[model samples]
Target: MRSFTTIFIALFCLGFVFGQTQGNDVLAMGRKVKKPKILSIEECKKIAQQEYNLHLGFHQKDTANYNLLKGAAITDWTIYLGIDDLPFAVEFLFAKHGLGVFTVVVCMRAERRYDILDGGSILMTEVLKRHPDAEAKLTISCLPQWFDTLRNKGYEVDERTPYRLYYFENLSSHFFVVFDLKKNGKREEVVIDLYNGFIQNIMPEWKTLEDLKRAQINFKPEPLPEMPKPKEKQEPKGKSSFPPEGKWEFSVTGVPGFLMSDLGKECAAVACTDVMIYWDNNGYLDDSDEQTYANDFCAYWGTNGRATYSQIYSGMPYVAEKHNDCYVPNGGGIRENASWAEAIQYFEALTQELGAQHPMVLNDYWPAPPHANCCIGLYGTGDDKSTWRYYRYDGINQLPQPLTVWRSSDQKWRPTAYVSGYCVGLPTVVWTSPLKGDENIDIGVQVQIHFSKKMNTSSVESQITITPEYARSYQWDPEQTTLMIIIQNPQQDLKFLTQYTIKIPATVEDITGKKLDGDKDGKWEGSPEDDYLFSFTTRGPKVSFTMVPSTHIESKTGCPPPNVQFTKFSRAILENKERRPFKVSFTAQESGEGSYELLVNELNLPEHATLCTLALKLTFTGNYHIDANANFSESIQGRDGIQITAPVDASVITQISCPNSPVPDNDWPDDNYSITNPSYPTPWFIDTESKVGILLNGFCAGMGHLLGRFKIPTVLVNTDLRILGTY
Candidate 1:
């Protein structure tokens, strides 16, 4: 063996040559070769010590001193080694497994002095290929020089302006050393690239240490106000110390009148006006002047100044409609006979359900004048008698104050009179006859309008109209709750299969002067232009057939007469059109040894003649007829041999007519028969070869024949004879 140094050099040269050959092969194949195993922590430490001449005493003592910095999946591993008594740390990164070193990072603390000899240099070919910014041959370390240069520039470097070393990624050989300078409350950061030995960038500031100190002295603070001292605690009061605890009061606002001087005299109208305003604020009614509402209410109730509870109740619905609100009244004197206790219970329940206080009109009958005012609240008084407080509006004041009244000894409350009824909003259209989109309606149908409450007939009549204008008469029920419109002598019977619409204009009002709430949306859908419309279609005319027996056969050779069948069919031919399909069928029953033949001429059928059985099913397109010839041959042996009856000749005339007209007679050839000579009629003959054309005149043309003339309207008809004979 050669010497140790010579042997190492020879082995390295041979391995390098082999790696070059293998790399060429990998490139040609467009594939990577298998990577070698990663170096162990001890192996990396030993290499660092040998290459850099470093005394890594603490790192060599334990495996914990070495930490593996894992790279991205595509990159390789980097090992960080921390040594004792050394100001700088070392990072070893490998490329493509452990084939070779990618880069090395020497990190130093802020107080430590940096040296270029701290870490060993390594070939950065692989790292530079992946990152062009990496240096292939880095000769000098700029970290220590950078601090010296900052000192030479007369800048202070202390704990507040500390420095840190950062290694961004394993792909590059370069790293950044960041220095932070503090002055006043602001920080100025400077970055220096160590690989190229150059300062990357800096944030500039004009202030020096002395300047910052001067600025700090100029700042001053403002004084804050002193807080108040606490007070002594106190106990809660007992319920008995005050009035009854269960007592509740309503803050119902009062409304003054526009026309009348004393709203107390017109309390019903005033209370209603106030309630309307309250509902308007709650989104139930539209806003309007209180005085205007009062005037309208008074006029609607037909009262000069004072109005009855019934009148007020009746007029509220109109107010609700006009304001686009709903009004619901307790009908039929519900509160008129209620006692004091019952009245209080009713008010309590009502207010609780409504979730708010409402002004109520009081009728005091016991007070002679039966004065009316608004009841706003109720108090428990701690006795059998409750105190009822009310707001009374006298024309002079805008907002009235509440007045209290104690219950009478007889248990009656103030307003000593019985509690009268009240009304809330409820506006709607109850129902309509010939409901929306109804079809096949009778031409003479009477349109009916039923409202939730009695309507003003005159107003409704003026607003009601029909499409395709027709003469009509209006009639109202006794209560004026339902309106009936009778169509009189309508033009062309309301036009067959035509749709007619009935519209009620929005201007139509109820007995209380409220307009129709067409859509029930709590708002009027405007007037005249936006009306409620409903439509219906009238039934089309009908077409049918009425068939009468034109011929019948009597018993022949003691054999029972054969039965004949007739049928008719009809159908609509087009959409909404009166083109109906018409069909007629005639079938004759067969007797013993008898055959029937039917011949049709000038008829819209598939074939002219049919043999074996007397059956004919014919269809017609319009007003047209078919001439049917029937022949029957019956063979019955008796004393007389082959006794055959004369062939029967008959004519069937089908005529089509209008729906309102009768069917007219269709002309046919006259019968020319010599009864005395007993000869066959002209144009009537018997075929000897087929034994057909045997006319049974005894059942058709001659005397004692069971046949008669008939007619049909808008239909198809058929008449013929069936002969019976003995052979």
Candidate 2:
């Protein structure tokens, strides 16, 4: 009986071999194989352990070693599924996924070979979230083709909505699903297009709901049995706004600013703090202060200037699930494991304050020491990437600092390689002209509102209320991203010398229906606490000032030698023979509206030489230009004709002529370089220039150049100007 059983088993083995001999590589070739059953991580690791050992043996014998997988070796038995939802591959993690993720695909077949995938690919994490009972086929096609093969296995990609857009409005959604199941037989996959709206199909052959309607495929199924309500009454649960239709996007006001230096190179934490401050101020969290939040965040994540991406979601993501008070749900961030262009767009949106107006922490992988910074804002007009404006908040002295570009994804114009770390919070308020507390503004000065995103014009217009009400007309830019309010002079024209205030309530919302986050606490309340209230003083009808002639004299101290002298012997010798500091002294009254001069030809004098003050003239002007009521000193430009200079253009440097006119009375010309003179229609200076301080350069022996430094005369426009109107 035992011999008979052995013979039967041998015959079964021969039959399997015979089936493969017929040119079909699949083990169950002519037979229908059920969809591979979904298994837990433990089950998959156990199933793939044998293959893992085989690869380990091969790595040992690979002496010639052409493969350049440089990292810590791997021996984990992990399985990953392709688009068809079948486990046909095992991963060999070198250090971590994406850095050196080696996959032995088609492992059950003799033709199996190694393949690589991006470390940040969503596929690594998407496996468990898939429908456990998806209808699948055991097809023999390679990767890209499998995307096409998925259709045969009862799965179809909505061509209208690309897969990359899955994160558009729904960060936690992996596939399209129909909420109404009462009238369905077998459910078909539905994909929501962020830009094009939602598309639900009832049949595989039909492309849209309209097609299904035309085909009469809407057979009525029994209604899903609804659960009965309890007899006892209870407080209604918070109605979730998720999966309502599309992504929940918003723009917050006042994206807070912080320097990495303030927190010890923890840009990720500091960036988080910016958004947190906004939320805390808006009553989202009960926190101590920004510094404490940042310190605690960095300490919890162990983000010692590294692991930025891992630090975001695990560190401190701002969302509804994390903080119930916040409006958006599911932690409010998109689940994107992206690099290159994907990463670039993520940070770009963060900078543009479009889509998700969240504070972003991003990486610069191309730099020798790859680094990251918080992207606080953007300053571009059109579609040009070159024109797009994004600035680094960390290490910047001001909020509008220049964009810190580490690399470009294309490896041209900028460095190549980047890692998109994480996104949170939001951005609003592009900029405001005649900034807060600005003075000398024209009575008819047009107020410009550049929103963080395209706005709904009606919402913004209805909310605008100017103080000391004046007749005004509105003109919107072509993109609806900027609004200009053209102010007309009052009937009495007394608007001059008065402070004007433009108040925009927090009720203004963008095209996406996200109200302005007035306080910029990363949340929207539409309350007065979030209102955008900015004020600027108008120029007086007559502007005037006189030069107060004076002289300045000083000596340079602690000026180091030209070269490095930190060596022990060098420091000892230099400390004993250090030269005495040189003297810098000068005086000025007036030269020209757009011109000034210095007299530095007599520089043969020894350093540290004390000198008597030189004579200067005083002048006043309210005709062609406004005079700065201050004296110019040449103490900066120790010697030479560089004492006085023309302040006409930002770049041009026309030095005062060498030979002095025998008459110092006509020393300077009369040309107005003053920026826009309000209250006076055409006062020599155009109504579109920066304020000019009529300062003349003088002598100074200091190492630093006074080339771009000068007295910018601000008009003493009325000190008692008051804003007396609101609507």
**Alpha-carbon TM-score of each model against the true structure:** 0.31, 0.28
**CA RMSD, predictions in order:** 38.4, 26.1
Error of 1 at 396 (Å): 14
What ranges in model 2 sit over 4 Å off? 1-19, 22-112, 116-430, 440-444, 451-463, 478-481, 489-497, 506-516, 522-527, 539-727
Please write out the lDDT profile of model 1 over residues 1-727, one tens digit for every residue.
2234323322443343345544223221234544222333344444433322221221232233111112201122222211111112344433233322223333333222121112222222222343444331211233445665665555556323434443322111224445565435556665454532333223222123222223223322121112112111112234222233344333333222221343322556766676566566555556776776777787887774466655655566677667654454431111334665455444444333222444444443433234444444333333333233433432222223223343232333333221222233333566888899999887667888777666788888887778766667899898677788876554323444568888887778776666777776766667643467889887654322122222221112221223432222211111111222212233334323223333221221111111121133322222223333222211122223553322112223332211112222432222212123312232222122332232322222222121111211111112333322111
lDDT value, residue 55 of candidate 2: 30
Q: After superposition, how far is residue 558 of candidate 1 from its true place, in Å?
A: 18
Best by TM-score: 1
lDDT per residue (tens digit) for residues 444-490 in model 2: 57789777655779988887898866667788998677888875433
CA lDDT, every prediction?
Answer: 0.40, 0.36
